[model samples]
Target: MTTFLLFSFLQLAQPSAIQFTNQDLQLESNSGYIQLDWTAVEGSQYILQRSMQPDFTNSHTIYQGPDHASFVSGLDNGTYYYRVGDDEGHWSDTLTLKVEHQSMPLALTLFGLGFVVFAFTVFVVIKGVYTTSQS
Candidate 1:
């Protein structure tokens, strides 16, 4: 049947491998997320896996879809490994991700300093306005 032949042709178009566009990534100290992208094949489904080990023995499947990109977020500070593959078991080179968030105390200190500056600015602005109205 025509439908059977079309399916056979699509199967024959299976790509030999999948390649991620990015090299190993290191997130900024305050960033917790990034977007992952890879080359895609039409009519083919891809799988993205993440692991703590280079061998991917304890890997987790993070995405399975036909899209070429996925958004990854909310990761704690650590190192991670990732790989992409098609339904035909063709996998690309492994990519590494390193996440290091800013320390809580340092972040709080910066926030407090900003608040102080803002309060001072507001006070100065109000005092200027009051003096100008009285003049």
Candidate 2:
């Protein structure tokens, strides 16, 4: 009887593991930003951490709240690692986010070059027409 009681107490004292409703987390990328979404336990405070290293040795907490989704922006093009943990210290699986932001300066330069070419073509065609009419 004592052995049974001890086993029951031990089982009750064991910490329960935190689980996410979706095992496979989804990552969405937008221009200049990335969004992380997951189905988590309601009313639970979670700590969101990010690191440039996959091992997460230098990870830092970006957010600590009850929200199950987070948005991160203004990050340079690179791979980032993220993980979430509850207040009880149970951590979720690590998620990898790869960012590839388009170069704004390059885009602007291409647009400007295209506009100049178009304007030059239109001017040449108009000049040729005017000269032929004069002739």
Pairs that collide in candidate 1 are none
Lowest lDDT block of 10, candidate 2: 19-28
Please list the C-alpha lDDT of all candidates, in the order they appear. 0.86, 0.79
Candidate 2 per-residue lDDT, tens place, 23-73, comes to 455443436576666557667788889998978999999989999888878
Which structure among the candidates has the greatest TM-score? 1
Q: In candidate 2, which residue pairs clash?
A: none
What's the TM-score of every candidate structure? 0.78, 0.60
